[model samples]
Target: MLAATEKALEAEMNRLKLAVKTLQGEDKSEEIYIGSYLLARLEELGVTSMFGVPGDFNLGFLDLVEDHPTIDWVGNCNELNASYAADGYARVKQGSVGVLLTTFGVGELSAMNGMAGAFSEMVPMVHIAGVPSLRQQATKPMLHHTLGDGRFDAYIKAAEQFTYSQAILTNTVSAGAEIDRVLSDCVIKGRPVYITLPTDLAYAKISSDRLKIPLPRHPSPNNADVESFVIDEIVKQIAEADGDVVVIADACAIRHDAIDELKDLLYKTGYPVYCAPMGKSAIDETYERYGGIYVGSISRPEIKEKVESAKLILSIGSLKSDFNSGNFTYSIPTTRTIELHSHWTNIKYAEFPNIGMKQLLPKLTARLEGGKAKALQLEVPRFDAHVPQETDDIISQAWFWPRMSKFFEPKDVVIAETGTSSFGILDVPLPKDSVFLSQILWGSIGWTVGSTLGAALAAKDCNLNRTILFVGDGSLQLTVQELSTMLRKGLKPIIFVLNNSGYTIERFLHGKERKYNDIVNWKWTGLLEVLGDLDGTLSKSYTVNNKSELTELLENPKFAAAEVLQLVEVMMPKHDAPRALQVQAELSGKTNQYAL
Candidate 1:
């Protein structure tokens, strides 16, 4: 006991000396709490807002977030919605990572689905879970949030399947390094990462010296010889193609931060550019070289013919999920395709690992600039907003999508739910600088409502234009509670809820008249009044049943530019679906093979 007491006293003396050195500015590493250090890193990454729910384990951390100078704690309706919101925020605010806070066990489990969806869609996010203290964990006592079996790692183990990296911060000594590693992985891999912050460690003082340097966003440089060889091979292929090559951009082209590099290739080479369903808005669709969306068999005949006939297809960041590629119907053989990914490249049958598009695109563009790949003047199908001629006043899917496209202005952020909206809006061309957000690969229904909240907040921070969301009534029921949180935060977004009678997409896929595909019909316009808009001062709701009413509403400047939140209930036939969806559903049905 005497020796232990003496050792404790010596440790105290050492701490005091370090504190004095810090105060005197002699020590370069300033001391800061672990939570503060983490928040500082997030702020450096331009995280203006974080989404989460308040729980006992995370309340102390929330105090730090509440007191933060720039980071706002966006209290959400639930953990799942918060996770979805974070995904949307990251999608809108490029070059920044989305931050999510949740309590251990139940809270983190609730957010698991959203995190998995973000991982599937390649959205960069950091999910910080506040767990029990070190002392508590050491005692192995039965905790409220944990199972009675004392299996504390169960949740994190479950999260391992979804996240790119995981960090369990046990001590202040390693807290900064752990945080940096997880955050760097989150951004570099463009996927969600899990970090467990114990309550005790949240305030533990750690040296902040590492915070002086920013985290590395890009991966390490490729081998000089290998990179040069790869670039030369790509240039040779393009030059030999004699302008028979085409460029197809997909979802990862945007998520991996290769848009600028991709645009350079498209412009300099003058190659006809097409995007997959998931890659909408990755490049400027208004450009003359831009063709329409390519979804394999589901694509329009003209687009399919144009893309399939190319001798060589340069596929950038291609994620050929079933829906994105029309149920794996891509006819382009591996021998005729060159694929560029975030961390590797594949030329025909040969794979060149570690040669990423972000670094290689510039070299390829430079080589192709001076007549290496002769610029061709090929005819691109004009993708303009043209409302179909309909005799009836009732709004149909074909008419609604094109008409809505006309209402979109430059720099608008458009989010679509997975059902009708995602397929419906795919045919329409958005204005330049417009952002398109959708969970195409994941296809999570009702994600748009929570995403709109996050996207709107991000839009506010980035000083972008209006945020518009299109969601089906059936899908909205799952996440409608998030609208209250949006109103509380004073975010103005125009939400168009298609009030069809039932699950239209499911009907098309299977069980066309099944009762399971039906949902409870809510009083569409009374939502705002019940959801904290008692005085009707903060919001407005409208129900448009016909083309004339929607046309007038879309044209009204006050309705379009409302300072308050707006919800438009668009009445449409229950059986109608977008043409793209009809084609996709048939392909998906054949793949499902329920009868077989």
Candidate 2:
């Protein structure tokens, strides 16, 4: 009896010990200031780094950042560059949130362009800004950095346009909950969120016991029944169609993690599947049966004929916008057209037969299982196969891309800048499941370099290798400061910069008459070396002025080992005018009376 009692006592003591350890592990008992608490919540959300310029209002938060080991504050030349860097980091991090901090008024305002890009691309990020104290709200005293009447109203308005949610931490009591709410929404929605941390609240103590970190709600498809029925009807129409069937995927398709199932449906139906420009990396780019970019430079006469003859078009996760559809030339008949969308919100050009993709994709995949649908077998006629090779010119962007394409495997990521490099890479074939990221909708420059760093870090965690960035000389100079962060994190990315001396795309649009299109050129390789901490051991520059030199450099194994190899002075004649540039110019001229 004594033995049994002793054993029970021992077991109870062991349980108590474990409970104590678990409580000790939490360490949530510390009474930290509100700003500190907010920073702690950011850490919990897996944001290991922050990029921004510190100002008077945010200096206290910056001090807190210095003390924290988990979160590293990355300083940039300006707020605009910092925002771009944070956006780049978000794209590369893969499920981890990007954080950007800025002071009130101009500092926060400068980040709007980059934040808007994140919103358009659906990259998750948290943008935090420092504002004046809440106590001075009623008096409306002259706050430093305020625009008019001591208010930062414009910043809030700009943030509303780009973020999924916004919060203003007015006092110590509201800081913890507000930070938790904004971060939670960003994770759940897969979009950017904004929060304003008042300067006066930074040092105010908050009770740790009262702070409750609530679990975020996952939004599910609400009208499942209607969505399913619509999908079934659309699939039935496609199954009955005669000529051919083609599926064009968009950004939302990639966001839903439905690419694999979409691929399976396409393969089963034997229909050719093509991706919009923004949706290039949504599926395995190297899939043997994959079709090329359908709406951009790769769009050929044969492909257009197939699209026109197709009795039914399945646009899964597409917006059917002007750019995605090649200026609405490939309009679908109401009886034969089907659209799948993530949100049921009203979409533009909704005249065609449409339904939410969230409901459509799953039902279509299921119904098409065991049902027979004829395969699309259209011959793609090569336009340039017969052209004689030119020997004297500098390396064409088109020629360089194919060579670089060979280096990319199924797991590699390609981030292209918004210029000649982006247009050049659109035609380069990718391996299956390889990702391609760019600022498509917002059309921002200097995005690719920073985004590549973030992507490399994310890829490293997944055991994926090789995050490549291709940027123009003009774009690289805009946000080159982020190279320090990449070096600090020990991220090795092969940055292939096309050393064009100007904004080639803008010059192409403006007919080379605009002197503003040209940029003061830099020796890119030397600049990168100067910025980062390399002991001169990194792979360096190979200036290729002609096609022969480029070919030789690509073949050399030594080129790969170099940490940052800037292919300097590669002259590409604004020869092949990108189709998108032409369209954009026409659209701009048509929409704006003054441009005419």
Which candidate has the highest lDDT of all? 1
- Which tens-of-lDDT digit does each residue in 1-596 have in candidate 1? 22222333453454454444344442325788899989999998899999999898988989999999999999899999999999999999998988899998999999999999999999999999999999988887899988899898899899999999999999765677778778878888999999998999898888877676566566655666898998888878876777678899999999998898899888888888899989999988898888889999888888899999988899999999999998899999997899999999999899999888887787788888776235565667776768999999989999999999889998999999998999999889999999999999999898888899999999988888999999999999999999999889998899999999889999999988999998899998999888888899999999999999999999999998868999999999989999999999998888897764
Candidate 1 TM-score, C-alpha based: 0.95
- Residues 466-515, model 2: lDDT tens digits: 77788887888878877766776677777776766778777665556677
Query: Candidate 1: how many backbone clashes?
Result: 0
How far residue 563's Cα lies from its native spot in candidate 2, in Å, is 4.4
How close to the true structure is residue 460 of candidate 1, measured as C-alpha lDDT?
89
For each candidate, C-alpha RMSD in Å?
Answer: 7.9, 8.4
194 Cα displacement, candidate 1 (Å): 0.9
Each prediction's whole-model lDDT (CA): 0.88, 0.66
The estimated TM-scores of all candidates read: 0.95, 0.82
Q: 514, model 1: CA deviation in Å?
A: 0.3
